[model samples]
Target: MKITHYLYNAFLIESGDKKLAVDPGGLMFYYFRFSPLIPKSEWNNVTHIFVTHGDPDHYWHADRMAAVSKAPVICNKTMVQEIDGKYLLLGPRDKGVAFTTEFKNHHKLSVDETIEVDGVTITGIKTTHGPLTVKLGPFSKTLNPGRDERIGWGAIGFKIQLDGKTLVNLGDTLLHKDEWESIDSPDVLMIPIGGNAVHNTMDIPEALQAIRIMKPKLVIPCHYNCPAFFSKNFNHADEDEFRNELEAMDIQYAILHKGDSIHV
Candidate 1:
């Protein structure tokens, strides 16, 4: 199996004759001028695409890529209702915030369901997208007039099993102790280490704690340091800090930059 990173959370997974793409959306947010990341022309081999949520940065290029690759898009049910053939894609949002964008074609999957696409068996795991806020341009403002608000959207993680190996992709999520009970130990674990202090996702310490619980043989950090529009300050998670933590716990991990590929 070979995994290639493309900017933010977008990734290309190649195994034998199958190529799968995860979260192809990049730089589509209204705040950014344009996506710094561009889809490669060679994506013709993609057979399946997985989208963890409806965030623009995660699903922006999904329809475009699917059109070229002729791949089936697997996403949550809300995302399925958001597409009309290929032009307008809509997703459930808080009042005043409607569907985000339109796409060409899409297939929706539900949480806890296992589906086989091409040769891969993927199981959707439950996850939370943290509190929701009213999105305004590049910034988000709390919606509640006076009281603190807790907003959550339907988000999910994935456990992809193929070729006798299991790889887990935990989309944007906070470290929830219950998730450990739902997922089996995987061969490779792709986790987000950027949203730590922000509370939107796991930080370095929380991710390390997750690693200890999941005990995957290999760990890859993702969903951090992409376009400036998505994050005000962008920097790859402190890899050295991660490395030291891994050393103390005796965990093995690999850090890949955009456009880098790993073969396993």
Candidate 2:
């Protein structure tokens, strides 16, 4: 299998004829102009799309990609709402919390729920998105995910079983040791390590703790050192130290920059 990393938790996993896209998002900050995380060149060939949450950096291009690729999108049930018999999806570019986009081919799953589609087995893993605070000079605003909020709405993790291998992706979430203890070693574990500076996901140490619990064979750290607002490295991490520690534990690790890939 070939796994490609696009900054911010976005990935393209390819095995056989399947081209799966995880969090095919774009840059969240409107002020800065940047290219799409998962470039458009691959959109038409994507076989399936998996969304972990509704964050812009994680979901901005989902609608467009699905429209172009005609791929089935798998996400949390809360992201879609049945209105007048039409299943409207949470708008990726809408102003606030609005279910405006429509995706005809989609599947929704709740925490701990499992579903099979086209020979692929997917299980929803429990996850909790932390409160995110954005600051600009003296003005600051905080958004929290809740029953009526959209900041971190429809948050979930995915345990995908395909090609006789298990891959786990924990999209921007805080550590859930008790809930994730049952998850045995997976071939690949895509985790976030930028929570300290942004207070939105697991930090390096917290991610390390999760690594120990999950015991994944190969670990790929993400959601750090990204471009947001006016900073090029908004969510910084000490990857060198992280690699050293993981290596000390005899764990395999890969630090993929944007546009990098690994084969396993």
Candidate 3:
């Protein structure tokens, strides 16, 4: 099996006749500026696309890629409704964003459901997106304090079984203990190592704890080190620090740059 990283959480996995792309959103400035890590020409071979949530950075290029490749989009129910047959408006909240010229079909998967598409077995796993807090102008408010928020658009993780190998991609999530029992040990585990301290996703320490719990043979750190347009200073979590922690735990990991590929 071969896996290629396309910056942030976007990845392409190829094994035998199957080609699956996960979280193909790459057009926004929060993730990338002008071009995708993997060019448009490389997307033609994609057979299936998986989206973890409704976040713009993760769903931006999904429709476009699906239109060209005619690949079915696998995503959460809400995300499927958001872009089912309508053009996507890309921008800040309420200001209206740019729209895509194409539309594609979306397949919604709930947590704990398994589906087979294009020779790949995909199972959705439950995940949380942390506390909900929003900032408006100079004021910040907690929209989901106490028990109001339900974790970032009902987010989910993916357990992909292909070519006799099991791979798990935990979208943006907080470290939850229950998920360990639900998912089997994976050959490759892709997780987010940023935003734990900030209450949006798992930070380095929490991610290390998750690594210990999942016990995957290979671990890949993602959802960090991308450019942010709203802020003047670009903030990124350190993969080297994550590597050091992983080494201390005797866990194997691969730190991939944008567009880097590895075969396992």
What's the count of clashing pairs in each model shown? 8, 0, 3
What's the C-alpha lDDT at position 56 in model 2? 87
What is the TM-score (0 to 1) of candidate 2?
Answer: 0.97
Q: Please write out the lDDT profile of model 3 over residues 1-264, one tens digit for every residue.
A: 999987768899988877888887654464336345456887898888887864556766666787788888776654432467563432212122233333455566788889887678888888877764444478776534222233355378889999899999988788887766766569999998767434667888888878778888999998776655454222258877888888988888899977788899
**How do the residues 1-264 of candidate 1 rate in per-residue lDDT, one tens digit apiece?**
998887667788888888888887766343645452436575688888888865666765666777788788777765543335443444322232345554455556677888887678988877776542444478766433212221333367889998989999887777877757656569889998876444567888888888877888988898766555455444347778888898888877888877898888
| Worst-scoring 10-residue span by lDDT in model 2 | 27-36
Over 4 Å off, model 2? none
The lDDT of each candidate is: 0.70, 0.91, 0.72
Query: Predictions ranked by lDDT, top down?
Result: 2, 3, 1
Off by over 4 Å in 3: 27-37, 81-104, 131-151, 230-235
Cα RMSD of all models vs. native, in order, equals 4.6, 1.1, 4.5
Q: Which runs in model 1 stand beyond 4 Å of their true positions?
A: 28-31, 36-38, 82-106, 132-153, 230-232
Candidate 1 whole-model C-alpha lDDT, 0 to 1 = 0.70
lDDT of 2 by residue, 14-63 (tens): 99999999999888683665458998998999999999999889898898
lDDT of 3: 0.72
